[model samples]
Target: MIETKDKKWSMFGHILMIILSILSLAPFVLLLVSSFTDEATALKNGYSFFPEKLSLEAYRYIAEQWELIGNGYLVSIIVTVVGTLAGVMISAMLAYTLSKHDLPGRSVLMLLLTFTLLFNGGLTSTYIVYTQIFNIKDTIFGLLLPNLLMNAYFVVMLKNYFEHTIPSALLESARIDGATEFQLFYRISIPLSVPMLVTVGMTVALNYWNDWMNGMYYLSANSNIQSIQTILNNINENIRFLQQNNVGTAMTTADLPSATVRMAVAFVGILPMLVFFPVFQKWFVKGATAGAVKE
Candidate 1:
C-alpha cells in the first residue's frame, strides 16, 4: 500500500514538472516566433504563438552588420573560454587550500573572502579603480576582469565539495608515498574534482557569454571590442528607435530584416550555451549534489 502511494505521488510530481517546463519555455518560443514575423505584423498583433508573416529581412540586416556583430562574437568567445579556464583553476586551487584544516590563515582567508559576498564597493569606486588605477577601460581586459575572475560563491561551493567529497585518507596516503603537495593536488584532487570544476567553469562561462553591461559601461563602439550580447543589444535598440521615429529615409522596409534578423541573432547567440549544456549537464548535476550528503 505504501509503495503504491509513493508511485502515485511520483507520477503527480512528474506531471507538475512537465507543466512547469512548458510554462518556462513558452516565452522563448514566442520570442523566436516574433523574431521571424514582419515587424509591422508583430507590432500590430503584439506577438502571437506563431509567426504572422515569414520574413528574412531581419537576418539579412544582421548579416550586413556583420563587421560589428561578428567582432562581438569573437570577443565574447575569447573572453568566455579564457575566463572559464582561468577562473575554474584559480577557484579550485583556492578552495582546495582552504579545505585543508592544517593550513594556517585558512579561516582568516575564508572569512575575508566571504565578507566580499555580503558587501562591495559601489560601481563608482569600482569604475574609478579599474579605469584610473588598473587602466582597463576600453580594453579586452575590461570585459573579462571585473566579473569573470574568482567569485565568492564558486569558491564556497568548491570548498564545500573538497571538504565533504574528497577523502582525507587519500591525501594522507599520497603524502606517505612521497607525493608533494602540488602533485597530490594536480594528480589526485583535480581528477576527483572534475565534476565540480566543470560545473563552476560552465557557470562562469555562461556569465561571461551573456554579459554586455561591462562593455556598455567601459567601452565605446570605436573601441572595436564589442561583445556578442552588446552588439545584439545595440542593434535592437537602434532599429526600435529608428522605427519609432519614422527615420526610414536611409532604410527601406524591404531592405531591413528587422524581425527575422532579430530571431536569427537570438538563435545564434544562444546556440553555444545550448550546445554546451548537454555536454556538461552530467558533470553539473554531479557537482551540484556532491556535498549534499555527508559521508
Candidate 2:
C-alpha cells in the first residue's frame, strides 16, 4: 500500500513538473510565432499560438534596419565578451583573496564589499562620478562598466565556493612547495572552481548582454557603441514616436507592423541568449548546486 502511494506521489510530481516546463516554454513559442505572424492578422486578432497567416514582414523590417542592428550586435558582443572576462577574473581573484582568513585588512575589504552590496550612491551621483572622474560616458566603456561590472553578490558566492568547496590543504601544500600566491591561485584554486566561475561568468555575460540603461544614461541614441538591447529599444521608441506623430513615407501607422515588430524586436533581443545559454546550461545547473551542500 505504501509503495503504491509513493508511486502515485511520484507520478503526480512528474505531471506537475511537466506542466510547469510547458508553461515556461509557452511564452517563447508564442513570441516566436508572433514574430512571424502577419501584421494585419496580428493587429486585428491579437497574438496567437497558431498565427493564421505567417509573414516575414517583421523580420524584413528588422533586416531593413540591419546597419544599426549590426553595429548594436557588434557592440553587445564586445561588451559581453570583454566585460564577462574582466568581471570574472576580478571577481574570482578578489573572492580568492577574501577566502584567505590570514590576509591583512581582509575584514576591512570585506566590509567595504558588503557595504557596496547594501548601498550604492544614487544614479545622479554615480553618473556624475563616472562622467566627471572616470570619463566613461559616450565611450565603449559606457556599455562595459557602470553597475553591471563587479557584482558584490557574485564575489561573496565565489568566496564561499573557494573556502567551502576547495580543499585548503591542497593550497597549503602548494604554498609549502614554494608556489607563489598567484601560482597557487592560477594552478590550484581556479581549476577546482571551474563550475562556480562558469556560473558567475554566465550571469555577468547575460547582465552585459541585456543591459540598455547604461546606454540610455551615458551614450546618446546615435552613439555608435550602443548595445543590441539599446538599439532594439531605440527602434521600438522610434516606431512609437513615428506612430504618435503620423510620420511615415507612405504607409500609415495603421498599415505598419507595429505590434508584430515589437514581438520581433523582443525575439531578436533574446535569440542569442536562448541559443548560447543552453550550451552552458549544465555548468550553470552544476555550479548553482556546488557549494549548497556542506559536509
Candidate 3:
C-alpha cells in the first residue's frame, strides 16, 4: 500500500513539473513566433502562439544594423566573461575568509557584508562615484566594475556552504600534510565547491549580459563599450523617436516593424543565455540545491 501511494505521488509530481515547464516556456515560444509574424497581422491580431501569417521583415531590419549589433555582442561577451570570473573569484575568496572561525574581525566583516545586502548608495551617488571618482566613463570597466561585481548575497551563500558543507576534519588533515593556506584553498576548497561556484558564476554572467543601466549611465551614444542590451535599448528608443516625430526617411513610420523588431532584438539578446543555460544545467541544479535538507 505504501509503495502504491509513493508511486502515485511520484507520477503526480512529474505531471506537475511538466505543466510548470510548459507555463514557463509558453511566453518565450509566443515571443519567438511573434518575431517572425507579419507586422500588420500582428498589430491587428495581437501575438499568438500560432500566427496567421509569418514574415522576415523584423529580422531583415535587424540585419541592416548588423555592424552595431556585432560590436555590441563582442562587448557583452567580454564583459560577461570577465565580470563573472572576477566577481565569482572575489566573492568566493571573501566567503572562504569569513568561513574561518578564528579569523580576526570576522564578525565585523560579516556584519558589513550583510548590511550591504540591505542597503546601497542610491543611483545618483553610485553614478557620481563611478563617473567622477573612478572615472570609468565610456570605458569597458564601466560595465564590469559597478553594482554587478562581488554581490554580498553570493558571498553569504558561499560562506554558508564553506562553513557547513565542507568537512572541517578534511581541512585539518590537509594542513597536517603541510599544505599552505593558498594550496588548501586552490587544491581542496575550490575543487569541492565547484557546484556553488558555477551557480554564482552563471548568475553573475546573466546579470552582466542583461545589464544596460551601467551603459546608459556611464557610456555615451558613440561609446565603443556598449553591450547588446544597451545597444538594443538604444535601437528601440530610436525607433520610438522616429515613430513619434515621423522622421524623414524613404519609408514611412507605418512601415517600421516596431513591435516585431522589439521581439526580434530581445530574442537575439537572450539567445546566448538560452544556449548557455542548458549546457551547464547540471551544475546549476546541483549548486542551486546544494544546501537543501534531504530528509
Candidate 4:
C-alpha cells in the first residue's frame, strides 16, 4: 500500500515540476520569437510564441554594424575570461586564509569583509576612488577592476565551504610531512575544491558578461573599450531616442527595425552565457546543494 502511494505522489510531483518548468521558460520563448518577428508585426502584436510574420531585418541590422558588435564581443570575452580566472584565484586564496581558525585577527578581518556587504560609500565616492585614485577611467582595466571583480559574498560562501567541507586532519598530516602552506593550498586544497571553484567561477563569469554599468561609467570617453553589454545598451538607447523623437530628424523611424533589433541584440548578448551554463550545470548544481548542508 505504501509503495503504491509513493508512486502516485512521485507521478504528481513530476507533472507539477514539468508545468512549472514550462511556465519559467515561456518568457524567454516569447522573447526569441519576438526577435524573429518583423518590426511591424512586433509593433502590431506585443510579443508571442508564434508570430504571424517572420523577418531577418533585425539580424540584417546586426550584420551591417558587425564591426562595432564584433569589437564588443571581443572586449566582453576578454574581460569575462580574464576577470573570472583572476577573481576566482584571488577569491579562493582569500577564502582559504579566512577559513583558518587559528589565524590572528580572523574575526576582525571577517567583520570588515561582512561590513562592506551591509554598507558602502555611495556612487560619487566610489566613482571618485576608481577614477581619480585608481585612474581606471577610459581604460580597459576600468571594466575588469570594478565592484564585480572580487565580492564579499563570494568570499564568505567559499570560506564556509573550505572550512566545513575540507577535513582539518588532512592539513595536519600534510604539515607533518613538511609540506609548506603554499604547497598544501596549491596541491591539496585547490584540487579538492573543484566543485566550489566551478560554482564560483560560473557566478563570476555571469557577472562580468552581463556587466554594462562599469563600462558605461568608466569608459564613457573610450567606446573602443566598451563590452558587448555596453555597446548593445548604447544601441538600444539610440534606437529608443530616435523612435521617440523621430520628428524633423534626418533618420526616419521606418528605416530602423526598432523593436526586433533590440531583442535580437539581447539574444546575441546572452548567447554565450546560455551555452556556458549548460556546460557547467552539473557541477554548479552539485556545489550549490552540497554547500548548503552540514555533514
Model 4, 142-219: lDDT tens digits are: 999984544888889889988988788887889999999999888878877888899888889999999999988898
List, residue by residue over 1-295, the lDDT tens digit for candidate 1: 9999999999999999999999988877876776777767766676788755766656667778888777888898999998888888888888889999899998899889999889888889998988899898889988988985438899999899889888888888899999999998898888788788887888899999998889988897777988999888888877777656767667765445566666777876887888878878976677556634245
- Model 2's lDDT to the true fold? 0.89
Best-fitting candidate, measured by TM-score? 3
Which residue pairs clash within candidate 4?
none
Q: Give model 2's clash tally.
A: 0
Tens-digit lDDT string for candidate 2 (1-295): 9999999999999999999999999999999999999999998899999878999988998999899899899899999999999999989989999999999999999999999998988989999988999999799888877855548999999999899888877778788999999998898788778888898888899999999999999998668888999999988998899889989678788877889999999999999999999888987677556634355
C-alpha TM-scores of all predictions:
0.87, 0.91, 0.94, 0.92
TM-score of 3: 0.94
- Clash-forming residue pairs, model 2: none
Better of 1 and 2 by TM-score: 2
Off by over 4 Å in 3: 148-150, 285-295
- Lowest lDDT sum, 10 consecutive residues, model 4, at 286-295
In angstroms, the error of model 3 at 252 is: 1.3
Query: What is the lDDT, from 0 to 100, of the residue 189 in candidate 2?
Result: 80
Q: Please provide, for model 3 over 16-113, each residue's C-alpha lDDT reduced to its tens digit, 9 standing for 90 to 100.
A: 99999999999899889999999999999999998999999999999999999999999999999989988999998999999999999999998999
